[model samples]
Target: MSEVKKIATRASYGSALVELGKEHDDLVVLDADLAAATQTGMFKKEFPDRHIDCGIAECNMVGIGAGLATTGKVPFVSTFAMFAAGRAYEQLRNSVAYPHLNVKVGATHGGISVGEDGATHQCCEDFALMRAIPGMVVMSPADDIEAKAMVKAAYEYVGPVYMRFGRLAVPVINDRPDYKFEMGKGIVLREGKDVTIVANGLCVAASLEAAEKLAADGIDAKVINIHTIKPLDEDLIVTAAKETGKVVTVEEHSVIGGLGGAVCECLSEKAPVPVKRIGVNDVFGESGPAVALLEKYGLDAEGIYKQVKEFV
Candidate 1:
């Protein structure tokens, strides 16, 4: 098999847009004056005419993207997750979600991984905000490979979509070029009977390690990679809850309303089980390295293992 072509989520959006733009003339890129940071610069370079930098006006950017989508254009709006989800939520709901527009909102720098940029830039509530939108498709990929796949999926998916990618260079677990991806489906990275650690984005890798550590302690841990928070794979989550009888949902976002919340909501309605959510508690992010932020907030692998330990 050929080597995997893993690109950062931001980079993937740039590269994939290059391909999508070539095939479809209606594909357009929009940035709230964050093209360089979000890697939408790649699209701007490739197709300058199709890229629009809307300056720091996030609300206007979202409105313009939704408008373009209504006019038969596929607009991929790139910006920081905080601004994309928090700053312009009304636009996302009223313009994009209400109209069911084909607008891909590519939010880079999600979670505390925005790091030194501090709390102002870190979007801990992004998932909660996006998930609350009725017609929004919330996706957060775990690695560069999956990030690329998710970006492609967002392009093809109709209606409002908020897909975020982080800044730090996380472990590239599935970098193989041949790997295919599907939205709204959780990928099973490992199988076990003791307990299930359901996670997505950066936590997928941490949970994998947590599961490994658990196995060494004679605790078989099942890891489910939930890349899509909205339209979550109910079958997979319910089955995992049934098989394990215990679960630990982890994510880089806040503990209140994110992946953990989504999983708990699912488990509560369908497969009731002991769930321990491992993520950022009610706290604002501080300036530090990405890993430090994750550790400080108890969103690391050790945190995941500890949370699972409680439920199991």
Candidate 2:
């Protein structure tokens, strides 16, 4: 069997920006002294004049991005999730989201997969924070293809957008001819009637693998990749929940107010099925190897498989 290709969503974000820069002259990129880490350096290298490094001040960088947007420029503010969504949250919420600017906040290194960077850097609450802002589009890509497509989509769609990317290289699962990318829509990867596994980001691939394990055990699991958190594909989730009678949401974020929370909120009112949220359970992550941390936190394929098996 051929080995699966893996690439970090952060790398995809950088490459996608370069692609968009070529097509749109008004597309500018701003970074908070994390161009290299956030992969915005790719854009800076291509368009030095359009790229702006706002030093280490994430808040000020957001302000600059917001200002640029007012002049009809689509600015993508790049930084670590901790800084972009956590540190500069006030500026993003007020300056960008409040006024509904055409600014994209590219937050890389989200969740416990940030590895040795530890609790301070790992931003598991960004989804919840971004989702709270009215009219803000929140998204997380599952692989390189989806990440690139999503970046372009965000640029084309005018408004405040928050996109989360992971440092860890994940497998390319959506490289099929039938694959499509649509904001606020869920993709059902596998069809089954036993239970529904709705996941996003790194967790989508893990959940797919877990579904395979479940299949081996005669537990048919329907897997859905919900890339968009805000303006979530509630109809898809509700339909899946109604068919399966049970739902399991997985994400590389805290269970509180992340994908799990969003799923629960949708189902409680519409479907009201039994749910199991697999993610960081309201606890801070410690410094550890990224893979090891995922295993420890029950975000790995084996962990998700075990949890889903028990739930079923």
Candidate 3:
């Protein structure tokens, strides 16, 4: 094994916007007073005229992005996950999803990894909220590489898109040159027959590590990275469940109405199996370091390993 490179998905999001901006002239960026934090400042610096600062009003920012979309502009809205998905959910529902506009919402600081920001800033239910909207494309990239690729893919995709990224730096798991991000498709990182671990966003790396731990114990666990949550890869999920007869879903969001809920919903309808969900167990987050928070909430590699062992 070699030393892996680590980078924040938020940083990758900023650079992805700058890279995509050069190609798409209609691409416009919007932020609500936290461009620096969300990393949308990179786009603002490069394309000043195309960027809009809507102050601290997240709702107004989303509305502005919706309005821009109506005029044939591709607007990428940026803000914290709490505000983008919670505060401005109404505007997103009406202005963006209702009309099926071409708006890309970049929600950073998603999940408990926001660290010292605490419960208020840490959004563990954005995935659930966003996925409920009709015609909404929801995505949570696993790492920087996937984050960049998803950003570009979301821009090219029509209608509304909600992309969640984290503030903490994570190891680059998909550094292979052959890697390509396809919308609504889940990528299998490792193949096994004992169990299947389906994970997204920050938990993907953790799940990979858990798989390695399981392998050492003679438990061959399959790892699947679901970058796109909505329009989830149903075939993949069903196949994994049918093949393994056991399934585990890991996420940084709440166990309710998040990836776990989505997986259970799919399995119940298609292939019923004993599924274990690893995430925040219907509780609010507290102030702590990002990694510590993950550990306490049972969202880390060790936590996942324990949960999977118990589940099996």
lDDT of 2: 0.96
Number of backbone collisions per candidate = 4, 0, 0
Question: Which is better, 1 or 2, measured by lDDT?
Answer: 2
Residue-by-residue lDDT tens digits, candidate 3, 186-227: 999999999999999989989999999999999999999999
Q: Which of the two candidates, 1 or 3, achieves a greater lDDT against the reference?
A: 3
User: In candidate 2, what are the lDDT values of residues 35-56, reduced to their tens digit?
Assistant: 9999999999999999999999
Question: Lowest-lDDT window of 10 residues in candidate 1?
Answer: 1-10
For model 2, which pairs clash?
Answer: none
lDDT accuracy of residue 142 in candidate 1:
87
Q: What is the C-alpha lDDT of each candidate?
A: 0.86, 0.96, 0.94
lDDT by residue (214-261, candidate 1, tens digit) is 888899999999999998898999998899898888988888989889
Sort by lDDT, top down from the best: 2, 3, 1
> In model 2, which runs have C-alpha deviations exceeding 4 angstroms?
none
TM-score of each: 0.95, 0.99, 0.99
Question: What would the TM-score be for candidate 1 when compared with the true structure?
Answer: 0.95
